[model samples]
Target chain A: MSVAEKLIALDPLALRADFPILAERIHSKPLAYLDNAATAQKPQAVIDAVTEYYTHMNANVHRGVHQLSERATAAYEGAREKLARFVNAASPREVVFTRGTTEAINLVAQSFVRPKLKPGDEVLVSTMEHHSNIVPWQLVCEQTGAKLVAAPINERGELLLDEFEKLINERTRFIGIVHVSNALGTVNPVRKIIDMAHARGIAVLVDGAQAVPHARVDVQVLDADFYALSGHKMYAPTGIGALIAKAEHLEAMPPWQGGGEMIRMVRFDRSIWNDIPHKFEAGTPNIAGAAGLGAAIDYLEAVGMDRIAAYEAELLDWATRRLEQVAGLRIVGTARDKAGVISFMLDGVHPHDIGTIVDTHGVAIRTGHHCAMPVMEFFNVPATARASIAFYNTREDIERLAAALEDCRRMLA
Target chain B: MDLKDLYQDLIVDHNRRPRNFRRMPDANRVAEGFNPLCGDKLTLYLKLDGGTISDVSFEGSGCAISVASASLLTERLKGATVEEAEALFADMIPLLTGKLPENAPREHFRKLAALEGVKEYPSRVKCASLSWHTLEAALKNAGQPVTTE
Candidate 1:
């Protein structure tokens, strides 16, 4: 193996040691966590960052002239700058912190698309979006007389780019698409999609919840109008995320939530809104979570996103090859371009049963529709077992997953 | 945490070849059960002869525990009255929830004892009881479809 490759995940102890949960034992066996697509386990840096924030700097942000408040506000706002830099945003003014990807999408749906939509207007999305991406747009479409259109995917779980292009029309007001499908791991050609939408003057919101963790995303390079990301999916604490939008989009969007911190001044009849980012942040935010997210960003940058991607790609290839050799195991998604996720079904065995069986061996994987029911229906199955890999995962973890599946097959199939 | 405890031989056998796995087209009562967590869905049909469950059957897709529990329910509830079926379902809940009295008669759960291991897998307790909940909803004539969200 090359020196760079050896220095990465192949040097498993160095990277794996950073995550405290890697040493955990389940059912008298070493835990093999392959559920990165759902939520990633935090490293010590992230956990310590959260602890540092709460222990030393605990105060409500944007409030008192007190020292703690200033420190807390500095940390909170510093996290926003870090998020902007992570996505290569033009300015920190474009990044708005929210609860997570769900809230981020909902904010765009309510504040951006709802006003622009009219009767007979359409909002476009892919067939493989999480419920969070689909349901929010559906709610906005329902409120207005607008329609929601989903572009289809092929047997390989790849989006039909030509079909997606054909669906865009003059009446298509907005497009919401997932950058990486959590269920299938298909990384959509987001740049091409964004270009197509921009050609017709339609804005697109890229659900980057699954993308930001595994790959480097440059908003400036992709020219994405809006990008929604979840902190928990990227080894940060839960209840914290950011929506990176164009400065023009943020400036034009009406504040969806009106509360304590979102206004410049409140009047009896009307309330004046604050600036670009803070106008959208209404309540006392998850400041500690954001600080932890900043720490996670530091950790990833220290390791380098390019190296992480290369290491995970190798691990994913190893896992796919290992799982394919097992008898009666069928992989569901086989897109030409994919991230570090594999969804498969074993003959005569339900995904839930496989999940339970694997848990006995301390191999943790996700088994379900993965919040993409439409994708499951298209595959003609109820659910599939998903083993999503990360840079910290070793080859032994994949072997344990394969062995556990064979045991499941022996018991049930 | 043993795999055999959850996927016992009887559960595997029934899931492979479920009994009365068909739709009763002319049944008087019917209910659809859905577990949104794992997308296990089942449609239960009943042929009631004046409050007596003259016939019971289920048609749907699910895991071993779900399919086996439904198959066993159909096998045991045949020829039972509505009250008797409800009482048996009531008796099955404790087995799933780990609330069964230690001194309770062991004879009561002859076939259903296979599902007792579900108490160990808390996330899957709904899989073992999806059908029974659907049966309860059907008995009560709940117009809405039952869901273990």
Candidate 2:
């Protein structure tokens, strides 16, 4: 049997009980949530972690001397360690907490890359990047007089590696690429891209927002200079994410934001910055969010990322096959190596109409540019209906989606 | 909300083959409407002759609700006076928003009542009213593009 078949042979539905929201009904029908790329539904373990932190151990971290403060500090720092291990970073000191993937990229753009950029320095990025990766570099380029260059992608939404290498001249100082596209589910060859950039001494940053939830990520193996991921996308709470960078880069980069916790000593004249990760994380961080992320990591490890990856792969294969059976439905992206996302357009139907029709059937899917307008432009489509799968999703969800789509076709006809 | 209510036969037919869905070459007033949320976009054209709408048309792509609303608007405003069009706009807002009283007279919105189903879906209100909003902009001769936020 194939890997997908073997994984599906096992009962994956047993794991669905962990997420309470999945059991809830929508429009009197069982909710078929296919919007995992936008944000995943949090598990009860993560929810309990946040509530437990706020209920029993609630205090500011890093400066408190009381018992509760110590406990909170341990939990927060413990989460940092858990995340560092989750991504296989060299050390927890290399992990810096931020608001989300957007903030993490912005921090790197402003703190690490901005100071070194010159008037004509170029930053290379792919056309498939999410706005979080593109906009931060654009803002930094605007401020620093640097140029932002985009590499081309093929009709299948796969990045053209040869064209990307051709664009890499001496002026290219940084390369920002997404690990997996949220719009097309294309898993770009990030390790190869990073190695190509590193060969020329160009620092590479990988936006792992859509990646960490689907597959295993090893920053050390990939040798990526910087990798950013959002906790919310990985079944954790919102408003928390991490940026994992090399120790040398983190040490060399200046602090982006300044506040209480980031300073060693503050005076009217000058202030000494804190060391490493703490230096980058300014102000009072999201302690409960960190606890929740830690719990999320624990949950993922318990279920095994390898199993989740296999199960989701099976789910994606099932969904792709079922969706292909629908007439007049054209999938936007067909990369050879895709994750769990499938973006498609129905005959003479706008994505919004499709979304509304399916929503009445209790099927949830994302519709629109998906924050990747450049991808939309490249595909020559105004919008597309996307169904992104998670491990908890089943073949029945895909069936529901197909049925709802058929209903939409008949009604719109 | 029932899907049948939202996707009525009239709305779907109008969406498939919208009426007056073309550009007016000698139009004096034109305004474009865009809803960035769902990528619904359209440009409305109006030819006013002595304070009365002589010709009305629109050209763009949008959802079923948006296209149907725009098509219905063109048909309703074909020979309407500027004052009558303005009054229709005032009547349309309450119907889409469910703010009209139970006894409120809707004779002015006769054929346009097909859009009252939008009141059930709060998020879709912007789609049903985008063309109407753009019509208001065209009537004012506002050069700026209208966006339904």
Candidate 3:
């Protein structure tokens, strides 16, 4: 049988047993954690890796001649190698450790974008990008006297490729787009974006912060110029992320930050910087965080990305159907393709009230602008209550969420 | 507490048919207040006479709590001396904050007593206080004009 068929054969209830925290309760009720897109729950493997690092190899990496330092360096570099393989990069040298996707995007914007851009030169981004993607490019453009351009999305939250194509011209030097929108969960055609940008000789940066945890992300297969993701959004802990870029691009860009480790040699007169990945990675790294991320990737690979994707797809469909059945509920972002995000507004109740009422019933969901104010503006609503799911979630969770919404509506009305 | 207790009958009555809620054509000081967090907005028009509040009016959009607070405040503070209005403002804060006991200042507060239930909800404190806070700033500005949050 095919792998897809085999994955479909496995029971998701059996898979839920692996996530220990899912069994816990909140507010005197069993936890119905539906806010996976904000940050995922860490698996035991990742937590164990982090604890084991502090317990045993508790030394700063890459500088000392002590045995502990050597062990720390090995573990840290080993994690980098694991990440490079996981993302299908050409070499580990092309991957740079960052605080998160926000810092990764800022690094590229400062080093690569600021130098190449001239006044009136345009950097194209989509309307659906997170504030992290939009604000950094805006600051870069403002600082360099360049202009920032936005490609508008359709009413259904899908990126209008025709609008994106029209926005690109001789003045356009780069295209920064999100692989999957954090607000709408609309998965863009990133491969096509990369190909189109390549044709125009414009580099493309894909914010894969949402995509990496849920989807099969082969950076090599996508052929994106730059791909950024946050570890915390995956099963890994925060304060560690990776930026995957082409080697040639890295060579051309200057160092974003200057510090001890990123330099090769220093004289009184001048200093020489280190090569590719090290140039971007300055000072002491998040060694423990890297180990945690390595373990998270291992846990994900064990489950198989295709299986997780398929399971999440089924969950999303169930949630969409169930939520739409509520009398006064209106689901936002009904794109032809989407991930496990359900943003909706109840007819008479404010989203904050909805969140409060839902919480009383033990279902935790995110409300308000959700750090995507512009998308809320696009929908012509002040805010929305969002319930985002993951592979660990079940159909019962969706039912709980739906039932809670009904109760909340009646209470508010 | 129940929703009716939270959004009391008095509050619903005030919201549905507000008193002293028209724009004052002969107002001396007018200011707009916006609570970005909840998206509640209001504009207050005050007609001051020397150190006394001569007349007060308001025109804007907001929720039941904010609208009722404004309507109740207008009735309490109109024709009162500036010092008395300030004293009333002073009493209202702790009363609405639930720092004072339920019957601590009930007879004095009268109609303004309706908003006493707001203190239980920390987030809605801003919503209940939006109009009153703006009125305080507007009065202070009329007393000695300056900038405020």
Candidate 1 segments whose C-alpha is farther than 4 A from its true place: A1-10
Q: Number of clashes in model 1?
A: 0
What is the lDDT for A128 in model 3?
A: 83
Poorest lDDT segment (10 consecutive residues) of candidate 2 chain B: B1-10
CAPRI tier for the interface of model 3? acceptable
DockQ of 2: 0.78
Candidate 3 C-alpha error for residue A238, in Å: 1.7
lDDT accuracy of residue B58 in candidate 3: 86
lDDT string, candidate 1, A262-293, tens digits: 99999999989999899999989999999999
Clash-forming residue pairs, model 3: none
- Give the per-residue lDDT digits (tens) of candidate 3, residues A1-413: 43334456676666566678888876677888888888988888899999999999879887999988988888888888988988899999988999999999999999999999999999999888889899999999999899998888888999999889988999998889999888898999999988999998999999999999998898999998899999998999999999999999999898999998899998989999998798888899999999999998888887888789888998899889999998899988878889868888888666766776687678988876767767877888767889999887888888998899898666555
Q: Write the per-residue lDDT of candidate 2 for residues A184-274, one digit (tens) a residue.
A: 9999999999989999999999999999998889999999999999999999999999999999999999889999899999999999999
- Worst ten-residue run, lDDT, model 3 chain B? B140-149
When sorted by TM-score, best at the front, the candidate numbers are 2, 1, 3
Evaluated on the second chain alone, the candidates' TM-scores are 0.96, 0.98, 0.87
Better model by TM-score: candidate 1 vs candidate 3:
1
Residue B63 local lDDT, model 2: 92
CA lDDT, candidate 1, residue B8? 86
